[model samples]
Target: MRILGLVFAGTSTPDRSQMADFLGDTLGLPRVEVGGVEADLFELPDGSTFAVASPGGMGAPRSVGFLVDDLDAAAADLREAGVEVGPIGENERERYLHFRAPDRELYELTERKAGIA
Candidate 1:
């Protein structure tokens, strides 16, 4: 399982609206829509995604996701290493799985589609 890059980082705040203003207006990161919701997605020039959500929007307050060359192999390797993995999540561009790390934080491994970076 070869790790590629840090593809995503997200944090859930009780005041997402305020955070959104800072991210979009102050930082100048372009906002993208997620499932019809505005002001959550921000893409860096390098293609890494930073997201801010309401506390209830996700299961965890913070998440970090890495890019993996092979999702299935990584999942198998994680299981063999005794990691607790959650279900795989898929979108049009990528597939990802969440897992609990030794620190008890939830991290993600994503396999992007062929045409997507």
Candidate 2:
């Protein structure tokens, strides 16, 4: 599977343009827009896109969310591959299933709705 982006848990939703400018001017990185979400798509000279978003609000930083292409298929594949799947929260809009990597980092597979911008 292709990694669309890397989600970071930030304290607040910082000014998108300002952040983009800082990355472009100071860090010399390229920015890209994904579904109206402004992100420093190329930072650290690496190909990974950095997706910054505030979790729950200003002070509730939680987990990183990965936007996946196929929610159900990914979740099923994980389960069939012998991974433990977490409960799916329907009201959360996106379909999610969580699993822990060998390093104990919590990884979530999420399939977001299209045109959610």
Q: Best lDDT goes to which candidate?
A: 1
Each candidate: how many clashes? 0, 0
Our model 2 lands, by Cα RMSD against the true structure, at 6.8
Off by over 4 Å in 1: 34-39
> What is the TM-score (0 to 1) of candidate 2?
0.47
Residue-level lDDT tens digits of model 2 in 1-117: 344565333223556557656667887766555444322344344333444444333222334556677777777777888777787643223455667666666666666667542
Query: In model 2, which runs have C-alpha deviations exceeding 4 angstroms?
Result: 7-62, 91-93
Error of 1 at 28 (Å): 0.4
lDDT score for candidate 2 against the true structure: 0.53
What RMSD does each model have against the real structure?
A: 1.9, 6.8
Instruction: Report, for every candidate in turn, its global Cα lDDT versus the true structure.
Output: 0.86, 0.53
